[model samples]
Target: MPRVVSALAALALLAWSVPSAALQVRLVPPTPRQGDTVMLFVGGTKGARDVEGSLGGQRLAFFPYGAEYAALAGVDLETKPGKVPWRIGLVDGVGTPRKAAGILTIKAAGFPVQRLTLPDGMVNLDPQSEQRAANEAARLRTLYDTVTPERLWRGRFTQPVASRKPGEGFGFRRVINGQPRMPHAGIDYSADRGTPVVASNRGRVALLGEFFFAGRLVALDHGLGLYTLYFHLDGVAVTEGELVERGQTVGTVGTSGRSTGPHLHFAAQLGRARVNPPDLYTLPVRD
Candidate 1:
């Protein structure tokens, strides 16, 4: 049986108070078992026609209608054993320009699962470093959950006529100069340096900034703990709070942040947990 967890409990305990205009979110797992397919739902909406979702780096597409949009996405049992973050972005019917979003942090399962141990040097960093990391994680968790337009689920997840081949890997374990570094957390596409990068799905521009490590970073809130990030951009074309469509052009790829070459670093976060992006696309999810 799949274990069920409430997204609200996870978000609330972490101090992510709901935003006044935030979309309502729900996660309905079939049972209280690990590694089961779970359904994520958005309620109290209107004229929605399609949903665009992504976890880690994978993307999902399905049609939506009426007051709610629901999608069944697989949550891992063994990997990402902490709170799970899932993001969903929706668009209403034709010519109705609006989008809505929110986040969901699926509470951990009843039974614990063992995850790989990190080096003491990293985990046992100085108190300040550890605290900073924790704070950042919490902040990111909160931002991932609540940043969205007051009433719009902009974007669509359409099947690429010919799926663009992933130019680089997602979630690849990495070691820099023979020392371990953060695993590659996103998908890389080898497109022309200035080619316009499209919004993977409908979402609001919650964050568009430059960072030491992320270079030119752009975050899209697809609501419900689900967020998509684009990095190493040559230029960002959208402003914060702008509504975007699934295929809207937002930026171009570049060697920004800590990158060595021009490529798009596409990543997704569900609450705080980052899963395999490819899994989001290949997993057998239903609308």
Candidate 2:
């Protein structure tokens, strides 16, 4: 079913708190779990404006909401469970700069363990593959470290595939050949070879190329430090620096890199926070 969340329903589901004071701040879901997206709501008389904030020192972007301001925050899947401080500063309608601070108790999340056996050579990268992976990692970091402040993506984020068929769950502890590897950060959707993959939201294509493990890939810069990545593609249709709509075709699914079958690995990032793309789709943000 499509996720259409109402304003009233959004409050109940997020477990947000409203303070009695005229000016107040609340974190949706109150306590954010790993691989989750967070929404910060500021309530005030004449409302909040020019809102600026940060979590763990990463800059946050805020949008004006009538008399108040709100911002989207991403908590990385690799974040350790503990107290995380988020600070906010905003100039009200009166032009007075007001600031507030809060602590988000990063809660623990449970992920399933997945063990799979692949070809020995595939599991172990060769020298050439290692070099490619290293170069790609450095290139990817340069793209992610860039923080775009524009609000390019609007409304609720949609699935890249029309069927919306679910695949492997995010945050899985992946073990290959008895060796534990990095946790699976993105959710997957199984599709046939040459299955078309579309953009999840409006954004400018940042990078498009064949990588070591990602295979044919496309990454979008959705502005405000938000990015969505599509990996293991059979064909890359979009080029770098192209603006794409929410449902624009980006690539095709295939068993392109270090894989056993055809699938699309969709990943999301907010600033430097690598989050679960599927989890972000559940949020109730409007244009």
Candidate 3:
């Protein structure tokens, strides 16, 4: 069940009193499941210059949303179900910093299992290929570790491609050739070859590479520890460090990087947590 924290109770949890009526803190879905991106909104911060917070141990960068402040936090797919400690800090108009603490409740989520029979070469990598993949992965990790201290995206996020099938395959435990492999961390959209793929939101192109497993991919840094990835492209249209608008074409769908058919593998990461890309559209943000 979703646990909605009341305003007064939230103030008590923070153990602080404000000059205003009350300090309002809320988690969009109340109780979020694993692999979900949760929005944290803080009200009663009328003249605050900056707002920041941390969930578990991951830092969150808050941006101005109307009269309040909002930030996105990720719940890892393997996060344990329970209450996790969260802290928030804000600098008032006079540079007076105030702090608040609370807890975020997470709910358990069950992912479906998928079994596939692929060629041995596709299932296993050679020594040389293994090293290349490792290097690529490390580079991606380094990119995710760096947080841009600004909000570049506006309004809601959109799907990268048009697909008749519903969004699925995220967090799916894959058993390839009777051997368990890492879970699918992204949503796959079946599209025709050369189908244009657009940026899910506005951001700067962080990296573009032809990877062993991901094939040709583009990663977008949406600022504030939020990133969107478009993988398995037929071709790329944007360059690294270029600012792209929302819905701008970044690549084309194709059977690249271990894919069985033409498709676009879209993913989102908040800090270190791999979150569902579809969740971005559900956030309560507007232009």
Candidate 4:
């Protein structure tokens, strides 16, 4: 009887020593390239009440996905190719907070150079135009800094325009008017002027304005610090703060901005990272 009692005691001790649950983390792509959008999933969190995380110093906004929690994060176009640290925190059912850490491997992507010749006035802005562009740029930075606490998009994202032509020039280094300029942060879609442009997914119209460089622009807030921008529009169809649905027309394409021809400039931002807009379509978001 004593031997049996000892065996039971040992078994009980083993059970007591092991944790009931452990925190788990996963990145959908496992390995991502610069300018790619990543989907982060956390499991083994059966009793977790809340979850939060950060990647490369940028905050991640988490939302419940079935039995797990997930967030969308972006690797900027200029992010150096290497390992980036990521950390996660979880609040359990009884309010006990736990933490987990890992590294994300970012692969290098080659971006080709693009050269164009434009009017000198457009390439080199006048003093007044320079100041106006600077002011508008600052406003855009402020808008991207705000994070919406919930996920407002559903299912997969679609192309913003119906043109059969594929997007081009994302992350392209541009030499315009014989002067080097910032890398192109968005993709261009060649289409006829007044071609309908629709929202890639459900979102709220965040801003609509005419600017020195972007021309008529419409910015959409898709929550969780994710935004989509439509630039160089011939016309705007929605007002700021209006809730928009997937595939709804937000504007029409045109060469309103500093452009050689009629085309749509579609861009995306996750937090402050300028990610490729097409990457949004590959995410595993549910309807």
Best by TM-score: 4
* Candidate 4 wrongly placed segments (more than 4 Å): 1-17
lDDT of 4: 0.91
**Which 10-residue span in candidate 4 carries the lowest summed lDDT?**
15-24
The candidate, 3 or 4, that scores higher on lDDT is: 4
TM-score of each: 0.53, 0.87, 0.91, 0.93
State in Å the error of residue 154, model 1. 7.1
Could you tell me which residue pairs clash in candidate 4?
A: none
Model 2 residue 55 distance off true place after TM-score fit, in angstroms = 1.5
Q: Any residue pairs clashing in model 2, and if so which?
A: 47-67, 48-68
Model 1 has a clash total of 29
In model 3, how large is the Cα lDDT of residue 188?
94
lDDT of 1 by residue, 1-287 (tens): 12235665676667634333344566554231333345556764465545566643434433343456665454543354444445666554432334444343444444422233434554346777667656654656678556332323433343211224654555556665455656666667776678778776777888877764567878888764567788888898899999888778888878776666677887766545454444445332332
Model 1 CA deviation exceeding 4 Å by range: 1-139, 147-165, 278-287
lDDT of 4 by residue, 95-213 (tens): 66878998999998898999999999898899999999999999999999988887899888999997758999999989998899988999999999999999999999999999888
On lDDT, the stronger of 2 and 4 is 4
What's the lDDT of the predicted structure labeled candidate 1?
A: 0.58
How much is 11 displaced in model 1, in angstroms?
45
Task: For candidate 2, write residues 76-110 as lDDT tens digits.
Answer: 88899999998988776656677888788988788
Residues 145-227, candidate 3, lDDT per residue (tens digit)? 98998899998999999986977899998999999998899999999999999999999999999999899999999999999
The candidate, 2 or 4, that scores higher on TM-score is 4
lDDT of residue 32 for candidate 2: 84
Ranking under TM-score, best-scoring first? 4, 3, 2, 1
